[model samples]
Target: MATGPNGSVLVLTNPHDVTTDVVLRILADRQVPVVRLDPGTDLHTSAALTATYRTGDQRGTLRTPSRELDLTEVRSVWTRRPSPFEGPPGLGEQERRFAASQSLWGAGGILASLPGAHYVNHPWNNRAAEYKPAQLAAAQRSGLLVPGTLITNDPDQAREFATQQTGGVVYKPLWNTPYKADGQAQQVWVREVRPHEITAAVAACPHLFQAKVEKAFDVRLTAVGNRLFAVRIDSPDLDWRQRQSLMECTSIAVPDRVARSVSAYLSISRLAFGAFDFAVTPTGDWYFFECNPNGQWAWQPDSITDSIAHAVADQLENGPEA
Candidate 1:
């Protein structure tokens, strides 16, 4: 539906993202008033901001090339993965750092305070939901079956946990961040960890260990509002993501219980969207893995992709669900 002239949807993400490309295309078709702003790269480049404050309240406007979005009339804000906040043009490292911090509190504070705007996943809520431990607890509480898991920085704890799990244990990174190795970016992959291999080096940082879940397949379930789009991935590898080329993806219906559990998780996490990963065993049971609150969906089939885009656009244009 075309948005009325009074309100606008603010899409926050980088330009190169395909997910942004597709969503914006749909919003364009719907004639939704959208301000596609990449706060990081656009703040000092093509964007300008102004605000007025009363003793207890604040109001603001953000001007992009084609639009001046009324922050007060913003229906929603969809924050994807934007680039890091660039401080100012032609500035030194320390000076840039200071400016970025100021920008984050200054402009960011006003945006976050927009009274009527529905955040797909509020920035603060998104950050909190990203933690592995936090997500696991929410999934468990939401009634999804989760594997035996442990988080520890002690080598002895890691050894004792691994020895108790019959199917063996695997070490998975607590967070997904690339590391520089030989001047190239690399990520740690999930691998089996034998109790004998546990060493004092495990104490260097927090490590996530879980009982190995032998699975018939994996599910990439992307949820937008109340809709769940599940794609079953059949792969022989320990991590299907490690070898996407060999994995076969097929659309599947989510079990009613699974759907309800995910919805409950979204409520507990205070999120409007989530991309969940589940391990499906041969006996047709599902085990909770993790959920990416701001995960990608454009890679799925056009049916799923377009549906999610439209669902997201609907929320942005129409405000919160009734």
Candidate 2:
């Protein structure tokens, strides 16, 4: 690793993140110094971090393989999908647990407290906005159209809610939890739920049920600071992510009202970047679904990717707007 000067960007993410790769390329092109760290792989293993607080003075340093970062000198920090710290190996279970907790809250606290560092959606804010119910509430409060939603562990309630929707309802997981069935990893996808299908299994855990939107297409709006990039997606499946290869996507204009609401939502959530999903009805009404503060975007069209990379680079280089 090479040392970076004062006021460089710090990127916390996994090595496989193509989004980070694209952003790094853009930052490099502009001669911006960046220090990338993967907490899961480097922290406590190959990297070193120290934080000291005394007499109203706070200081910290993070030494990565290629560079040493003065926490206070970080101009921007991109908290993208960095894996959890696993602590040192060869320790007993309880010892390892204690060490991991300290690493998370101690070292993590120092990074989170970096003065003068602009976090592109701080980790705490990202965790707060991840709640589906909270996201829907925020969207609705921002004047965005949101589908009637129900979260419960009662099968009867689930069935009744599904029955009330004229277009029927869909079952979506509150969180996309990775699971393994028959030794293969699987992810839950949004699927239409028939009234009868809402059985006792609903009682096993909480589920999110929403009135299905009769949509002609879907929209993915990526907001980078004040800039919004909207893309129209046409797909036959309810969850386009499942069959992404078959989906057709094109850059589209965001409605003035929708754009304003998106900006407001981001402002209210204190996010500098977000990927919002919406279902567009045939009548042109856009129904808000959810927003991923650290959503994937590099897989999108080249034009969209380049635009987002530029916006992120600009923010990291120039700091937040007044």
Candidate 3:
């Protein structure tokens, strides 16, 4: 592993991230300096930044209530789940919009532009990897087994595709975006859908439908750097994420074929870390579904979670390969 620039491991995330806390704990034990900031909420109230450029050199400082950090000293940036920028508190509608734009371009750009610091799956890379279409194309190119799939806005095509699947089709939200239901955030989980369920409403926008695998179980594989930790999840539900309590999790090794495919996929996607979901058939065929560039891993079994956290800490502490 190569050493990064000298200074703190900068963590840009919401204050309440349990996944981050695990890595932070290990970094703490290793006595690595860290400067945590939530740009969304803190930028307006508690944080300030200044950068100067002269004589073809750039230097800056980040000031927060608890710490003052030299911007150039950011060794690596973990842009983990940072919320959208929330501008100043009392601005009117027009002013708020303007402030929001300024903050995004100003603060967000600076963070993205740090001179010698490496980003753990940089924000731009994360956004690109989030697209299911891109992931599917990349997976196929990398030689990962992929289920028969379709993304369409035409109801007729959706119906035709669903009918062609012998094991039936499943509907999955392309983004799994949060929806407000009864004043609480809710998510639509993956579920089996009939051809009739592909109604005209699906024409309202693009819909992702896939041939449902009669999977013996699902695999959640967490890749940190070149290390992969996979957990086999056995569940009764059509979508295992629907009910985690009923999930039977056991650590599993990555198959050589799958490992090679994933490595190629990550290189193609320019991601240092990713959480991949796959469906394993009865005969041990692993089919790639999607890769989350900055997905959750701490929710896995304890050993897997701890090992991943340590791997992440090591990466942040030592930076990427030179």
Candidate 4:
């Protein structure tokens, strides 16, 4: 575990997460040595699972034997979205159990044990970022205006909250994660809150209700290390996702307070990268919504890509603590 002069970085991701490729290419162009860890590899204890890659125009699997990673020699890691492991259909119950348990515990443990390495989005930090309640509180503590919010399983409480807001409310699921039941993908749809529908909403799941913000413009503030890129998104629809065709997005100058708060939020959240969503009123008030730790930014205006890429490379090269 020797800390070398030029350390290596491991990119933890699926093949399709294009941002991973974008970042990797930036690192490679700078001559940084990178080892890509494909998550779909078989799990048989951390020691037994040797990973191999098939290069361009190659056919059969090239089995690169397993070796323990030298954590001290590693500089940084990017924990991008990983694809789940898939085992063949013929495995019986016992074999299936062995593989599944190893995937969850064994692989996860190895990643945790890596020492003195900077992570753009660490696994533990990524987990903490998912709780919407905590994010709202943190945003306010960082001096950003967060829309009044309520998280509840009770129907009556939800109804009261909606009725109290002068401007109407909107409902967002705590986590927009989908569960597959009988081969169907169930997605959480973001929608306006009607006072009459509170009963059915409460019956469905624990709801996160917030006053719908009236806006002059909506902004997505993307921060990579110390660099910040703010983009103003214009959409007439209640939810921006609803107006993909008609919406306009453009880069905007971020207010100093908003920029400061965004930097502070990222520092407190222990993240090197974040995509922050804000709703801005015509009077110039910016209300913080939430920051996506693993947010998508390729959809943002093309001008931001270089800034983001450069920020990531600079952090990866010099280390975030520096």
How do all models score by TM-score?
0.95, 0.96, 0.96, 0.86
| Candidate 3 lowest-lDDT run of ten | 1-10
lDDT of 2 by residue, 76-195 (tens): 889998978777888999998898888889877877778778888788999999999889989988999999999999999999999999998999999988899999999899999999
Q: What's the CA error at residue 260 for candidate 4, in Å? A: 1.7
Off by over 4 Å in 1: 1-6, 55-57
The predicted structure with the larger lDDT, 1 or 2, is 2
The TM-score between candidate 2 and the true structure equals: 0.96
Off by over 4 Å in 3: 1-5, 182-184
The model with the greatest lDDT is 3
lDDT of 2: 0.88
Candidate 1 lDDT score at position 59: 74
Clashes of 1: 0
> Which sections of candidate 4 miss by over 4 Å?
40-69, 85-90, 93-98, 179-186
TM match of model 4 to true structure: 0.86
Clashing pairs in 2: 1-66, 2-66
Candidate 3: give the clashing pairs. Answer: none
lDDT (C-alpha) at residue 287 in model 2: 96
Rank all candidate structures by their lDDT, best first, as comma-separated numbers.
3, 2, 1, 4
Tens-place lDDT digits, model 1, residues 1-322: 2234457778778888888878788888988777888787788888998888888766788988887877777878888877777698799999999989888888777766677678987887888999999999999999999999999999999999999999999999998877999999997899999999999999999999999998989999998888788999988789988988888888999999999999999999999989999999999999999999999888777887888888887777666571
User: Model 3 over residues 186-276: C-alpha lDDT tens digits?
Assistant: 8799989999877899889999999998788999999887888999999999888889899999988899999999989999999999999
